[model samples]
Target: MKNIILATTALVATAGVAAADVSISGYARFGATYSDNADDWNTASRLRLQFDVSTETDGGIVFGARQRFQTEENLSTGGATDPNNSNGARFYMSTNGFTLAMGNILGVIEAAPNLYLPTASSGMGLEGNGFYSLAANTSSNGGRFAWTAYDSAGAGAVEGVEVLYSMNGFGAHIHSTEYSYGVGANYTFSGYTVAVAYEEWDAAAPGGQVDGDSILFASIGGTIGAFDVALAYASTEFSGVEADKWSLKGGYDFGTGLTVYGFVASEDVVDESYGIGASYDLGGGVSLEGGITQTDEALDDTIVSLGAFFSF
Candidate 1:
């Protein structure tokens, strides 16, 4: 009987090893920043770590988990700690070209359109810089639930669902449903890609006000004789809002690891903002980047930042 128990334990250990795969990946960034206005100017830095683990069953179902840690710095105090930091985990499964994810995840459908560009920022300017839509308000949270479906061809379209909840911070209350749901689709062909998404916030406001917002985005990118060029556009609309918001971004890569990028965005209800940046790769997983940002409303608040990133 003891031998039988020992054999069962050995079999279980082997199975676990056979079903599991793990990887380590992260990036570190350090730089200096300057602002023309009163926002302050100083050194800037950030570190992020991500862990991914996965397993596959004999039935062709895949399961995995992803966790990340993010940290930032304070420009005025030169302190390393800030409340904007975040740490979270996500669990997901995939089978038969369908994928499902839950637990502290980004809103898939709502955030998809904004992620169309390859810029370092979250493309916040595209939607009136946090004015027309409440999407930016839910940047972090207690958790989120999501689902996705895709074609096996890899270049086909994808559809997804996202739901979010949090009990603290700006909008927190049992009666106030901080939930969102939407559908999105993306297609790629000949070095060009396009995506469209729409989302509705059940109770995005504080006083039980239900607000709905939608975003439309498209991008085209390709290589042209040792240079890479990309162009992107986004339009945003909100419920009960009279004007719409839009943004345009362009970038050119010199192939020698140097690239230039710029963006201009505006909304009729708010002032306009624009930025220009450049980046150069130093090889061996290191790169240098710098950019300048200005807004019409905050004329004195021009920001210039330079930073380096290392990935492994």
Candidate 2:
């Protein structure tokens, strides 16, 4: 019995050493938000947590998992327990410039390419209304399945996927629904990057009506000195109506933890909106940020927001 226990202890130590290559990292974001239009405002505070774990095998294969959690104040229901929440998990593998992910993951076809750009004031361009905005495309949720591929030379890449669903009548019945495949590609050279993507959705309408939609988008961005700039254009075609939109944004770093940024955007069907924002790093992974936006449609209506963020 003493010899058996000694052998088991040695095996456990060996296993622990073998698993030392695994790594874990994550971040948390919390902030407060207040809008000028209280009726349109939904929440004044929010919190989110994200975690990632990864390991590399001896044969050069890398695998990982990511999980995210989010909670926010429920202003519409006058309290916090109104079920306004979201969570998701994702798994991924990669090797030799090629990568693939599955499960409730963010769409690589549309979301991944833009992530290469640096964030402005801890947020994305257009103040969270980047390519993934519901205003940019009617559907915000991604397809059920997604795939990604990259060139061995690492100069270009592509991604595609599809989604399927069948819903019974609640107010209307959807016999069959599918968000068809999408493809995106990007090329980089000498500090400049260009990307383009397309997606299609097919839906069976109420009372046997058949209709569908398609979206196309392209963007280019680059950096110089303490300044960076980006321009993006997108088009959406649904049944009979079509809309086109574009935005331009740039920022300049003044050094010593201060930066200034500005953005302008317009859609064929909506008034032009423009805004400028600034951020000051308070040191120790904390920063102060604020911005104001104005639209031509409502000359008297302006949106303003300010907040602070600290990362551990």
Candidate 3:
């Protein structure tokens, strides 16, 4: 990763000192995972490279773009090129507390604050958020999206616009595609933060009624003593099926470069999930981490994984 950054910088130097600032950074991860359900042990690894370019115009507007390239391997698939993981250029303009972005922009609902849990190993080490599913079909959750433009099944690079504003301890975000729209707001006071968001689709099927979906999410998070805690709830209606989900997560820092976190969430009727994990910072942008996750199944279906992460 360092070599890649150095080479990129050298190439950029040929431009003879441009106004834009360019930087490259990424991470490499390798882990071993065991799943009781599959009754097998597996290995996985991944590498990602990200480039960020930004510049300020004379008009006091900041313009920027972010792009990434990644490669990965899993026990089942070995190694394969995943073009979908590579995002196209996303451009943005920002000033003061307001910012506007377009092209490959995250969906409003998916980008809403406090929607996903924050953890060192991303919920379950190598597995990562095994059961924290959301209703946004445009997200990685694999749900069905009612908006044609925002659907992951569509071809070509995603196109959308998002507007964001933040002032004092308050922030708001709004975004839309051709057939979908969403709004979100968050506020921080004292040591607590609260957020809520809503999103809906406008697709009308042949039956004369709106055939799309809508989602509402709310969350609160704060630091209490040595632990950081959060709770979130979401209600969604997709294709006539309505489901509600709630999750609680917390983390503690030992002040010795070690942190532990855990979460439990339930949705629908029989769905339940939980995970616990810890990470130790080894310094120099490296860490060792491990975790276990159990889904709504028999106790034997749990999954455990351990891994090392490197960032540059």
Best-matching candidate per lDDT = 3
The C-alpha lDDT values of all candidates are 0.48, 0.48, 0.66
Q: How accurate is candidate 2 locally (lDDT)?
A: 0.48
TM-score of each model, paired residue for residue: 0.68, 0.68, 0.80
Task: State model 1's lDDT.
Answer: 0.48
Q: What RMSD does model 2 have?
A: 12.6
> How far off is residue 218 in model 2, in Å?
0.5
* TM-score (C-alpha) between model 1 and the true structure: 0.68
lDDT of 3 by residue, 23-101 (tens): 9998878888887878988886777788899986554566688887766665232122342356566777677998777
Tens digits of per-residue lDDT for model 1, 1-312: 245336434544554333778998888777776757656667666666678899876655566777665565642221123424444466665555555555544443434433433544332221112211222222121001111211111111122223222222111111111444554555555655555554455544322224554344444455555444444444444444433345556577777888776666565555776777777889998877777767546243676767777788
Clashing pairs in 2: none
Candidate 2 on 54-109: residue-level lDDT in tens?
76655555566666544544232112233344344555555555455545434423
Instruction: Identify the runs in model 2 with alpha carbons over 4 angstroms from their true place.
Output: 1-32, 39-43, 74-86, 112-117, 120-178, 204-211, 296-301
What residue runs in model 3 are displaced by over 4 Å at the alpha carbon?
A: 1-18, 75-85, 129-157, 204-210, 297-300
Runs in model 1 with CA error above 4 Å?
1-18, 75-86, 109-116, 119-178, 205-209, 213-243, 298-300
